[model samples]
Target chain A: MEEQEKPTKVVDARGSFCPGPLMELIKAYKSAKTNDVISLYSTDTGTKKDAAAWINKSGNQLIGVFDREGYYEIVMKKTK
Target chain B: MVTNILILGDGAAGTIMANKLRFLTHREDAEITVIGNSKYHYFKPDGIHIPLGIKNYRDSVKNPKFLFNYGINYVRDSVTRIDVDNRNVSTQSGKNYTYDYLVIATGDRLVPEEIENFDREAHHFYTLEGSLELKEKLSGFNGGKIVIGPSSIPYQCPPAPYEFAFQLDRYLRRRGIRDKTELHYIFPLNRVFTMENVSNYVQKLFDEKDIIYHTLFNLESIDAQKKTVSSLEGEDQKYDFLILVPPHKGQQVITESGLAGDQGYIAVDRHHLNYGDYDNVFVVGDATDLPISKAGATAHFQSEYLSGRIASEISGFVAEELYDGSVACTTVTGDEKAFTLYFSYTRPPRALFQSKADYLLKWTSADTYFSGMLRGVM
Candidate 1:
């Protein structure tokens, strides 16, 4: 990842359950400025699939989904 | 020879078992039939959210018929009797079903009438209708004492009353009536929760929230006209609004069918979910006297083990897995935060503190889990 692609804010939602991580990401996105990248780290299995789907459906730009050791991270940019 | 399996009830337990059975058995090897009183499956846990206006009643309902895609027969009928001696069960419509094996998953029955004046005065959030009514009542409330009490123990979802109290506290604060409304939680047990760690954690939260807690206050009766409730120890308390978790018993059909124990619950071998002497009959969910919290999570865990057992038996092999009575529950404290507990019969429940992530996990996974259970994926 390039320095400019780095998230403005990183939400650590590890040890939380599914929608918990996604909800945090949405909250961060709501408070974020346009073009500001936000990354959510979650251990919940459903976060990767559900959050990606939600971001795509809401017309946000999903940078990438990464599977790290023991957690998954979803990066998104607040386009609107 | 084709094995005939008849399952009672179409709630969480019955539906999951039906879908799993369909997946495990060959079409020509077994015939699976499920009989339930209602056409729609209501996620009972979500009823608590209804009164708080977090979700609507319609969102919690799903057609049970939609779950029967794998050639399993779904019958919408009330069970009247189960002649275990003859291995036949009768329905209210005079339909008789004889089976080589039977699964009893009929859930608990709410009996508010057992308490005097409760039927007339106390409001509850257990049923779909009651939740909707409570939602309307809560919206118009301005101030006064709000009492949430459980009429008896062994109720479904052990954490519900406490969760309701927490959510109610949050609700009143949101409505800008927090100072005017006094929140009280009355429990039958000596502590807030049966599990020690959970009780201690919740007690701290309760104290921080300034919610009054009354312990060992088993409900005796309610005076609707006076807006008061009396405890078994002759203690009386007044309330402007009452949210009662009414007394629950095994479905009448289980007792009427002469398959229930003295406490009106099916007596099953705790580990195997089988009744002694009735080799072919098994019980699960709220219907069994399993000495565990009668919640959907318990049923889900039971299904995980029981499904394999039934499948092995049907395949002419001895079933091996033993259920550990594991239970997992997520308690929504308020709109933004929630907590979860996971435990088993032999272990104390481990508590996960309140977080927005936990809340979202519960909110998002509920629907997917429901659909997955219906499709026999989980």
Candidate 2:
């Protein structure tokens, strides 16, 4: 994980819900220039599936999904 | 332009939001107005103690005018119509109020009439009137089979019905009729609660307390004369006394205003709380169609975040902070013991160890509610 450049924007949505984390990620994505990296922190059990689906459907590059202590992290890059 | 903020329903959510927004935004920049169905602010968590006779209806009630911050306009009027398209509301008092932004905190209502012959025999703790009635009935109760549980899902204060059962077990024991009385609890969910760990923890307590409970039991009809309760699963349970948490629905004014999506709840963006297709309109607390418990703490957290958003946006700053959906609920286990469950939209509730401190905290919450929490300073 330390081998790559850090995310341009990190959205801390640890206690947020399904569409909440996804919406925050999209907000970051919308403002970021093309190729800007965005990472989202969430603890919602349903967010992993929804975020992954959104990253794929929205034509964004899904870098990785990592499980953290009491929460999870999803990293993506704006392509379109 | 001055932001004319109109908050509908001055419950836990609306009151906190009104006060917080007023504190954050200048009075000259934002005119914060709250319209309420009742002038009294109710401490609903203390409602569990009412049926058990620990607290009375007067103990949980407070005047809204006393709680509202200075410079906040409070209208003690019933809303007849919400003309959202025109950005104004018409009340039953023959007055119209206009707003530049709308915040809907008009909470849900218990609908016992939705079930067949349910309310006539059932005694619930959700309402002040019902709790008072239940208290009277409990005083005359000798000993019999008592059924306690919610009639439907998404009811406010998810842990309350469970708390009542635990408290009821103790109440019967205190009356020296524990051996003669039978306590049974039925939940519509596959488990006792929505969360797995909390449900498992509560299930163990029920076992230790010798309280019988049934899962996946969706109530269908009640025959008060025959003392039989029918379920959608084709099961029947006979009871001498019934205590059912009536099904809940959002405010009727929301549905009549054409702003509701399902069960009279307003549909809004999950993160921003923006009403469907209107960024200027937002929803907080039990009124929103969010998959969260409609508890006081849920409204408190939402109000905290929502006030910031509205205030920041009005102050011409980018509103960045979003609601995390944090909710805190306390379940009282009899014998002066209770446990508080703290979780959010993204997080699942963890196991709660019953403690006397939590019981004290739970009881003291009513006091803190009026002094700090509702003030939006705590």
Candidate 3:
């Protein structure tokens, strides 16, 4: 396992469905400063792809998507 | 010994079933074909956001050809008829396709002409064109009595009209004209929702929003010239703007084929989803005459169960899963808050109170709907 950097903000969106995790990520991204890392946890099966697509579209940096127990954590860095 | 499976309508139910069936019988010699009227499939739920200016019409549409994986034939043509006895379907383009198994997922049709003067007077939000037209109309309006409700029962998405009212209120407040606008919701039923608990909860929300609720107001006719809607019991209500949920019927092909029930919907076993006397025929989605809300969630649940049943029939395995008509819907109130209603045939619907998290879930479900459900991945 690689050593993961601590996130400046963490949005716990587990147990929420599709847009929930993605929306929370967007909200966190909006409030985050440049180079600030944010992590989102979600149980929705579609969030992994949605978050990745959103990150690419918004010109943010995707650090990694880690699959946790019964959920997934997506980390991103605010580049703009 | 090759089996030809034909599915009608490339909407949520048809699209999901096609992908699921293809996923299940990949190694087999079965042929899967989907007949749809349009090349693009629109997410019907997103239509609700159009009138409120939350989304554009183009964003809600997806090309069905790109959504389906390999080995599934997609035909973009209007269906003329279904010959159940011969197990064949004819398209308007003078082509006939024979099928060993048929799945009718054509969904429902909105008929505004059923109500007097509705076509000429009242506006609706059920169609893409209608939603856009309403969006344009709402942008110019300032204030007055805005009456919104279903013209009949069994309309698609039971909570939509209420959501429209809530969103409209939010829109009016944003424009600083809420005080001048009088909002009212008319329903044919006595309650705000189908379930008792959900109805009570929604009614309370309506009270909080200051939206007047009128129950048992069955629409009899719309007087376009007078700009009033009259109920069956001789009550007339004037309106500056009317958003009507037009009467819905099964597709014309289903009704003309004589496969529809008395209500113009296909009758199938609620659990097995098989049409009577036709083991190879299955029905799902709003087209079925099931005692449940005609919603995309219900169709999604039905497709999941029906795909397994169809796969079992083809692979010689017994399908143990039964459909319970389970449906889940998110009701968006204004201010980025929403409630979720989950229910089934055997269970009463329960509504989760207003929460920003639920609103986020509803917003994110669009991704799941387009990618997971449409692609047969979830």
Full-model lDDT, candidate 1: 0.81
lDDT of all predictions: 0.81, 0.84, 0.82
Highest TM-score, which number?
A: 2
Q: Give lDDT tens digits, candidate 3, residues B290-324.
A: 76888888888888888888888788788588888
DockQ of each: 0.01, 0.02, 0.01
iRMSD, all candidates: 19.5, 13.1, 18.9
Q: Mind giving the per-residue lDDT tens digits that candidate 1 earns over B146-240?
A: 88978876788888888888888888888899999999899755567656578788888899999998865667778877889886435688999
- What candidate 3 gets wrong by more than 4 Å, as runs, is A1-80
Q: Between 1 and 2, whose TM-score is larger?
A: 2
Mark the regions of model 1 whose C-alpha exceeds 4 Å error after superposition. Answer: A1-80
What does candidate 2's lDDT look like per residue over B1-378, in tens digits?
A: 788999998889989999889889998899999999674677888778887888767868998788899999998899989887888899999999998899988989888899888868888888777788899999999999999898876689888898999889998999999899999999865568767788889899999999999875668789878999977545689999999999888988888888874479886787788887887889999998787888888888888888888888888898577777788877798889998888876677777788999999988888898998899887
- Show pairs that collide, candidate 2: A44-B346
Clashing pairs in 3: A18-B364, A19-B364, A19-B365
Residue B1 displacement (Å), model 1: 1.5
